[model samples]
Each structure stands twice: as C-alpha cells, then as structure tokens.
Target: MNTTLFDRVSAVQADLLVTFVPSEGAFPESTAWVDGNADGQLSQLRESGVFKGGLAQTLLLPSITQDFAQPVLLVGIGKDAELSDMQARKVIAAVAAQIKSLPYASVALASRALVLKKRTQSEVTALIAQWLNEGFYNFLGFKQDDAEKATKVTDLLIEGDDEAALAIGTATANGSAFARQLGNLPGNVCTPNYLASKAQHFGEEYGIDVELLDETKMDELGMHCLLSVGRGSDQPSYLIVMHYRGGEEGEAPHVLLGKGITFDTGGISLKPGPKMDEMKYDMCGAASVFGTMKAICELKPKLNFTAVVAAAENMPSARATKPGDIVKTMSGKTVEVLNTDAEGRLVLCDALTYIERFKPKSVVDVATLTGACVVALGSVNSGMYANDDAVAESLKAASQISADKIWQMPLNEEYQQQLDSNFADIGNIGGPEAGSVTAACFLSRFTASYPWAHLDIAGVAWSGGAAKGATGRPVALLTRYLLDKAS
Candidate 1:
C-alpha cells in the first residue's frame, strides 16, 4: 500500500484521529464531532452507542446536503494512563480493516505514539510504521490464485512529517512483503534445497556469505537425528549457514538457529484435516530468520553474526522414521521417537548441536514447534523459554521496545524428566501435559552447553484473519535486540 506523511491534520476527504485520555476520562475530539446522546463530548458519542472506548466508528458517506470539511473519525484510545503501544497499533489496524471494503483511496492517520522509556525517536517511528501496514497483509496465494482482488486501500498516509516515521513504514512494508513471500510460497519451493538457494540469494544481494551442507554432507557429520526426520521425503534436507561480518573481521559472531520444516505431514503420524495445505508455512521460522538477516543488513549493525537453518520436509512413507524408532543426534544424544508428529524437536536438536561447531558467543533458535504453545500464548504473545537470564532479560527488553512481546515460561528440571526414555537417552515428546514446556525442556538440553534462548512461535507465526497476511514478521523483535547488544 502507498503511504504518505503530513505534518498534522490535513484538509482531505477522510480523517482518522487517535487520542489518549486518563482512566474514566470523558471522550474528547480535536475537531467537530457528532454526539449520539446530543451530549457535548465523545463519552456522549459512546452513550449514543456510536463508539466504544478505543475503537473505530465509520461515518457513512456524507449526504449531499451535509456540511463537512472531511469525514471525521474520532478513535478513542481509552485513558492516557492506560495507553500502550499495542493499543495504538490495534487502533490503526481497526481503521485500516474498515477501509478494506471501501473504494481505493488515500486515508490519512492522525496519530502519535508515546516515547516510553526514552526510546530513540527513529526506533519508535520505525516500529509503529511497520505494525500499521502489517495489519493490511494476508496470504491469498492458496485461495484459487486470485490476483484481481484489489486492495481496499491503495496507500496509507501517516499524520506526521517525521522522516523517521516514513522510513519506519517503508522498512516495515518491505519486511511484511518479504514475510508474505515466504509465508505464501508452496512448501515444495521452500524445501531445504530451496532455502539454501534462498540463503545464496541473500549473500549475492546483500554481500552475506552463505554455506550449504547437503544430506550427504550432513550424514558424514553424524546428523542422524536431523536426517531421520527428512529421510522419508523425496526432497533432500540440508543445513543452511549464513555469515554476516558487519563488524571488524574475526569478531565473535552471535549465532541464530531456525527450524526450517518446510512441510510436516507428521511423517508416520500423518495429519488429517482439511486445509492441511497451509502446512507450507512450517518453514516460516526459517523464513523469518532469512528476513531478519536481510533487515539487519538494511539496518546495518556494527556487530557480526552467523545463522544456522535446519531445513527439511517430513513426509510419511516406507522410508519415513516411525514411532518407537531411535536415532542419535549430532550432540551424541539418543532420541526415541514416541510419536512421529513430534518432529520439530528432532530437527532443532541437530541444528542446535550444529551451532556448537561455530562456537558462537551466544545462541537463539526460532521455531513453530508446538500446538501447546498456541494454547498457552494464543495469537498475541510468542512462548519464550531460555536457559540464561541475562539473554532472556535483553530479549524481553527488546520485545517491549519493538512491540513484539514474548512471555517467558519456566524451563525447570522437572519438565526435562518427561522426555527421559527407558530405552533411549531421551524421548522426542513428553507426556501430553505441558507439551510446550516439555519441548522447551528438550531444546534446553542441547542449549545447556551455551548461552541460549528458544522462542516457540506456534502462535505468533501466523496472525490468522486478524491481520491482512497470516505472517507477522516476528524477527523485528530480535533484530532490535541483537542491534542493542552488539552496538
């Protein structure tokens, strides 16, 4: 969507204003407004059943005789004391969603974000702009491939003239588009081979160096756990590594791990349901890493980093690994597969172990691993389980600043017991209860040897129908993090 920026409220055909007030405060409008109760304020506007607190209300097309400068929209952001960045983003989303059915036209947003914690103005503007356009994205690739669907909004107009905000919107739009490209691509085109090729593209386009380890090479390295999951698929699996030496040469590189399960049919434990095709997004975690790598290049940090992506597809057949099977990981840990569907951990285990070879100063991995994570965090917060508090604290701070909140869950010793196997060193899955925590525990074992964090992104990977595209581009949060730490 095209977006324009202005210094303040402008003389136009449409206007949407975002306001902040104190708790129990009466409704206020900067310009003239219609009161349903005939009362003087927006509270009266709410009393008339016209609008609730912090919501968007549509003013129908102006009557030919109605005298108006522009179609006025007063969006209440609740009391100023209760104002938050999320509320701010949601208010903008509501407005943008409303215009989806209307004609294609430019709509200006007259709003500002509170600079809490004294965040740099550029960071605040960039984050807000990214989220605003994020609301207009949706994945329609699988929907009969219809390209004629015209967006209700052709462009967006931010209220302020701050170059920072404009840059923010542009950067976010690029990120969102990047996410949609990955989220919408069919799994076949996003397999380990394809992803390795994508890494090469990243290197060529951005001057990053990418290394690809094929199945034969992985087999030689004793990555049986990772290979076992991909053995059933005709498509070969691979290990993808990209090095970004933005800092002085020989600097310690921060390592990022991504679980790139291109398509998961549960191997021997196949999934049965309509719309299973959406499983193509199984690789979104890896896609986010690729996107993050590019964004970091664009937002160029002074620190160096390396990223490892374990990219594979899980398909069931005679060659597929089954329940009750045992395999050894690169870390020399034996895993008994209790359920074929629990394959994400299998892939991550080897990937995390592989990162150890790089001897990264610190590590973090992203994955859409567990359904239990969806139950716990829903569509908003991503589940974060970390082995180190210092890393977790930095991540939490970055999350808050980036408006990509992650809630940390306990990764205690007790959770690890669930994965202990009588016949093997560990079980791929623990008992059903606390599946998310158990999965974190499983990953925690591999990470125990390093300063690491795990973000179980089952919930936040896709925004559902709530956002334009199901992909939310979660990397912005961590990107903000590494930049702060490295800088």
Candidate 2:
C-alpha cells in the first residue's frame, strides 16, 4: 500500500475522500474542498435527523465536484471533545472496514478531522496508519482457493504535512501485519526452523546481525531448561538472536527475550482436547518481537537492541519432559517441572539467563505465559511485571500513548515462597493461587542481573470463535517504548 501526505486536501485526487463531522460542531476545514449541495449533505442529513456523527458512525455521499470522480465519506468523531488515540483507531478501523470491500483505487483522509487530545499530529497519524494497515491485513497464505482473496488499498493519502509520521505509522502497521501473519499460520508451517529462517532473512535484509544456536550448541551451553521443552517435538529448538547496533559503540543494548513455543501441546502434562488447536498462538510473543524488530529496522531507531527468541515446539511424546523432572538452566538454577504446561517460562528462563552475557541495560521478556494472566487482565490488557518501578512506569507511559493497554502485576518477594521445591531450586508451578504472579516470580529469579519486565500476553495474543485470529498486540507498546527511548 502506498501512504503519503499532502498539504491541502483539495489538491489531492482520489476515488474516495474522507472527512469527519462532530455531533455538536460543523464539518472540519478539510471538507472545504466539497462544493455545492454535496458539501451540505452532512448538514442536510443532520437536519433531517439522519446523521448524528456519533463515534464510529459514518455516512457516504456522492461527490458533486468535477475535480474528483468519487464520493465523500463523513465519519463521526463523537461530541466536540478531544480525540484519544483509541478513539481514532476505532474510527479509522471502522472507516477502513467500510471501504475495504469497495472498488476504490485510492482514498484521501483529511487529517484535520482527527482532533488531538493529549497527542500530537504525528502520533495520531501513526496510529491512523497502523489501524488502517492492520485492518487491511488478510491471512490467506494457506488458502488455495481464490474464494477469499484479499483486495489491497492501492493508495492512501493522508491530508497533512507530516510525512515522517506517515512513514512511522506505515512501518509500525507493517510490523503488526507481519506478526499477525506469523501468528495466524499453522504450527506445521511456522515451526522453530521457519522462525529461525525468518530471523535470518530479516537480519540479512535489514543489516542486523543474526545468530542461530542449534540444539547441539544449546546442549553445550547447558540451556537444558529451554532444550527440555522441545525434546518431545520432531522439530528442533533453537535460540534465535537479532542484533541491531544503531547507537554508538559499546552502548548497552535493550534486550528483548521472547518465548517461541511454536506449537504447545502441554508436553507430558497434556492439555484438554478442546481449543487445543489455538495453542498455535503460543508463539505470538516471539511473533510480536519479530514485528517490533521489523518496525525498528525500517524506522532505523538510533538505539542498540537485541531480540532473542527461544524457539521451540512443546509436544507430548515418549521423549517429552515428564512432571517432577528436574532441569538445569543456563543460570545454574535447577527447576522442578511440576506441570509441563508451564513450559514458556522454562524456555524464557534460559534465554533470559543467556542474555546476561551482553550486560544489557534492561531486559524485557514477552510470552503467552499463563492462563492466570488471562483471568486477571482478560483480553483487554496485557499483564506486565517489572522488577523496577521506573521500568514499569515507562511501559505504562508507552501504553498510555500507544493505546495498547497493560496492567502492572505485583512481583513481591512473597510470591517466591510458592516456587520452592524439595528436589530443585524452584518449581515451575506454584500451586494454583496467584498463578500469574508466581510465573513472573519464576522468571524473575533469572533476571536479577538487570531491570527486567515481563509481558504475559496469553489473553491478548489472539481472539477466539468466529473472528479468531492473532491481535498482534503489545508490539505497539514495545515500539512506542523503543521510540521514546530513542528520542
């Protein structure tokens, strides 16, 4: 898709032109291009009690202008109140969905219609582009029939002067689309090897240094905690690292570790039969990291960063790690596997420990870690746990600005008592109480070397039922945090 900005809304020619109408106010300045009765259509509709410009409401009318051969879409922005990023996303996404099936070749969006609340034009622009791109995304890679073919929006014209925001928005959306594609694919096609290959390809294309540590190397390095999770699956596990050095030499990089359990079957502690297929989304944490990597690579943020994915597939087989099994992590800490379903932390713990070699400035790990997180935060917000208050505050600030919500969870030392094991240094499962906090407490043991945060994205990773698919979340939050750090 081609996204650009223009200084004047009237100067651009498009098959569709979009503007906004507030419930209690007149049309925005961007609608001045419309001439005669067509320009007054919105008022007529309102006067006739047909249009109220409520949030997410829209009305389409034929254009009377000879300069353009298309219609005008008047979207609602709710009262005259300041527009929030989440509101803008809803409006833009609704608009995108409305036009997605239309036969328009190009569309022009009036930037003036997007009223800024506590955000700048650039932030709003980026958000608008992100939602549009995400809404246009289709995961038909495996579909052989053309029955569900996707239609691409050829040109997107944002009526504004901020091209940088346009580019940033497009890139961020592309990153999200990339992650969604990865998350939507079947486990057979998106295995650990496939993820590793993608990392290598991304590194080669964007000049990032990529490294792939195979099972043998992991064995030599004593990453048993991570390696044990993949032993049951035919596909081997790997440690995939992507290094981007956009900052000065010797700068401590921000490390991002992702639990890449490609297809989680709960290992020896098999999950129930129902909804087990959704386990394919277990790697969404890794997919979000890949998405963030794609965004930062394109935007070329001036910051040193490293993304490490503990890529694996958890299956129940004769070779699977059984409950009560003891495994040693790279940190030399022993873990008792009480429930193999808690395998995400096993893989993540090793990777977190391994990243200590870099002496990272800060470390953040993302994973579909626990159902307790889903119970606590639902699908609306990701559960965030940080060792440092400042780190958690920074993430909260990013969440506020990016519209990707995150709720900070407790990480008190009291939670550590539940992880005590008679056979090992710690137990993977801490009974059933405070499950999410205990999971974080488990991983926190390995991240004591630096300021660390964990994002439990189990509920927010993907949707279920009729509209089931990956949400490609937390990427926006992560990208926003990185952008803030870069600035």
Candidate 3:
C-alpha cells in the first residue's frame, strides 16, 4: 500500500478520514477543521450516549458538507496525557482493522492531536504506519477463488509531521510481511531451493553478493555436520550466503547464521503425529534473516553484514543419519548424533564454523533449536544465549528498541557438561536438562573465534492455533541493532 502524509483532514482526499476522539467528547485539535454542524453532530452524539468515546470505541459519522468528500471515523484514544506508544499503536491497529473491512480503497490517519507520551511525533507516526501495514496484511496467494477475497486497502495516508517515519515503518513492515509469507507457505512449496532462489533474487535486486553452496560443494568444504542433517530428504540441502557491503572497504561484517530446516520431520527421531504440519515453519529463522535483509537493503545503512542459511530438510528414510552416527563439522570437531531430531544445531554449528572465514566483528545465530526454549520462555520472548556479555547486552538493547522481547539465558560451564559425548568429542543432544542452554553450548564450540550470541526462537517464531503464521520477530530486533551499529 502507498502511505502518504497530510497536514489536515481537509487536505486528505481519501474516501475515509480518521480522527482520534478522546473521552468526554474532547475534540482533538487535528480535527478542528470539522466546524459548524459536522462538529456539533459529534458533540450531540457523545452527549446523547450515541458514542461514549471510551478507549477503543469507534463511530462513523457521514459527512454532510461537500468541503470533505469522505466520512469521518471517530476513534477513541482514552486520555491525552496518558497516551502511550503502545496505546497509540493499538488504536491505529484497531482503526486499520475497521478500514480493511470497509468499502473504501483509500484512508487517511489524522494523527496531529495524538498526545504520545515519551514519544516523538515521528516515532508515533512510524509505529502507526508499521502497525497499519501489519493490520492490513493478508495471505491470499493460495486462495482458489479471487472473487471471495476482500478488497485490499491500497492507499494509506498518514497525516503526520515527519514523512520519513512512514517510509521506514512501511519498509520494515513489508519485510516482515515477506517473511510471514515465506513462513506460512507449505514446506512442499517453499523448499531449501526456493529459499536459495529468494536469496539470489534479493541479492540481485538489492546489490548484494550471493553465493549458494550445494551438497557437492558442502562435501568438498567438509561441511559434513550440516550435510548429515539432510541425508534423509530427497530435496538437496544448500548453504546460502548473502553479503551486503554498505560500509567502508575491508570492514568486518556482522554475521547472522540461520538454521533453515524447511520441513523438520525429525528423521529417525520422529516427532509425534499431532501438529507435525506446523513443522513447515521450521525455516522461520531463515525467513527472519531474509526479512532483516530486506529491511537493511531498504534502509541502506552504512554497515557491512553477511547472512548465512544452512537450508535443509529433516526427513526419515534409509539414507537418513541415524542415532549414534558421528560426523565432523567444518571446524573439524566431531559430534555423535544421539538423536536426529536435534539437527538444527548440526547445521548451525558448521555454518558457525563456516562464518569464521568472514572474520565477522560479531555473530548471532537464529534458530528454532529446541522445544525446551518454548517451555522456558513460552511465546512471549525469544531465548538468548551469548558467549560474550557485550553481544548479549547489544541484542537486549536492540530488542527493547524494537519491542521484540528477548530474555538472556545462562550459557555457563555447568551447561556444557551435559553435552559431553562418550564416543565422540561432543554429543548432539544433551540429556534433557537445560536443553536450550546445552544446545547453545553445542553451537558455542564452533563460534569461539568471534563475539557470538544465539537466539533460540522456537517459542516466538510462529503461532499455534487459528493465527498460525510467522511473527517475523527478531528481524525488527536484528535490524535495529544493525541500524544502531551503522549510526
């Protein structure tokens, strides 16, 4: 959707004009242009209890005069002094939801009177645009009949002081939507090859350099640990590397490693039949990487970054890597595969070792590495484990700024003992206790060369029930960190 800014409601030529109406019918200064009978109509409605103007309450008043060609939407925003960014976003989201259901193709958000506590006008405007895009999102690509699909809101006018905020927010939201689409697709359709193609397209369109390593190249490069994870699947695995050089020459880039198990069937270690379909979302980490890439490409910040995705499919077959199988990673570290279900770490470890070639200033690997992460943090926050304190703190600050919650989990020596192997140098699966931490510990062995952080996004990667789709999390958080670094 195209988002533009207008100074006043009179200047908005859209089919609908949105105005925030506070409690007790306190008219916002932004909507003061609706004088005479139109203004009186709103006051009379509030007085007669036709509209209470309570928080989240909305009223649609038809325009009687030709001065404004659209209807006025009265959105309740509670109190002025108490208005917060969260509340403002919620209000805008609610408005956007209503607008989506309406017949109008164009809508304007008159945000001048919004008293956003502790937030600048630009920040508020940006957030509103972001939420509006999210609210208006629809995944109808697979719908058989296009006639049943609702008419999309194509033009969004955000009446605010700063225009750049709307642009930034829109770009971020678009990236997120792209990630969501990738996550929501069935695994059959969105394979590792599909992700590789997407990466190549992104690199070509955005001026980034792309390199794809097939199973043959991976074998030649000694990526046996990563290659082992996809041994069961007919679909060949790929190591996709994307380089975006926006900084000075020879600058060490920040590296992001994603565990891309396109369809995780647990191989020899089979998962329960129930909810197996949701395993298609196993590639959400890679999807988020793609999302962040889209965002940074749009922002074009002066920072070098590289994203690597170890794309594979975990399936059960005769060729599948069985329990007790041993594999050497690119780092030459041996690992005993006690369970095939614990494959994300296998791919990520090799990728982590592979990333050392880049000599990255810092590295953060994103993955849905364990169910224990879901048990520990639930769906509220991604579990974070870092080998370095500064990397952890940097990501935490970015999470705060992006409003993507993350809790730092312990990666102490105590957890490392659980990963000890009897036959090999290390075990793939730690014996159930502190499972999330041990998984991080497993990957930490390969990332010893650089400042590294692990984001276990198992819980917050996607929703379960009716709203089952990717959240495109941590992308916002990751993007914010790079933005801060670029600045």
For residues 1-487, could you state the per-residue lDDT of candidate 2 as single tens digits?
A: 8888878776778888888878776566775445333646667776676978899898887754554556888788888568876787788888988787777879888866787688887778878888887888888766685445575569989877787788888888888889999999999999999999999899779989999999999999999999999999999999999999999889999988888999998988999999999999999999999999999999998999999999999999999999999999998999999999999999999999899999998888999999999999899999999998888998999898788999999999988999999999999999989999999999999988899999999999999999999998878888888888888
Please, what is the TM-score per model? 0.82, 0.96, 0.95
For model 3, residues 1-487, the per-residue Cα lDDT tens digits are 7788887666668888888777754577765566343646666667777877777788787764665546888888775555865787678778877887788888888877676676677767777777778777777677787445554677888887687777777878888888888888999999999999999899779989999999999999999999999999999999999999999989999988888999999999999999999999899999989988998899888999999999999999999999999999888889999999999999999899889889999998999889999999999899999988999999998886666789999988888888888899999988978899899999889888999999999999899888888887777788878887888
What residue pairs are clashing in model 1? 2-155, 2-156, 21-79, 21-80, 22-80, 54-76, 137-468, 137-469, 138-468, 138-469
CA lDDT scores, all candidates in order: 0.73, 0.88, 0.86
- In model 1, state the lDDT of residue 78: 51
Itemize residue pairs with steric clashes in candidate 3: none
lDDT of 1 at 202: 88
State the displacement of the C-alpha of residue 226, model 1, in Å, after optimal TM-score superposition: 0.6
* Model 1 lDDT tens row, 1-487: 6666766453434433333322244433332233322234545545665555443334332321234334444555554533356555666666556655456466666544333234555655665567666656655556664554445666666655577546644664566557567867887676788888888888898898888999999999999999998989999999999999888788678888888889988888889876577777777788778777876777667888887889889999899998999999998989999998888899999888888777777898888899899999898888888888888998899887777879998888877888889999999999989999999999888876779999988888875543423464577776777777676
Give the Å error, residue 280, model 3. 0.7
Best by lDDT: 2
Stretches of candidate 2 off by over 4 Å are: 35-39, 65-68, 145-148
- Where does model 3 exceed 4 Å of error? 35-37, 64-69, 84-86, 146-151
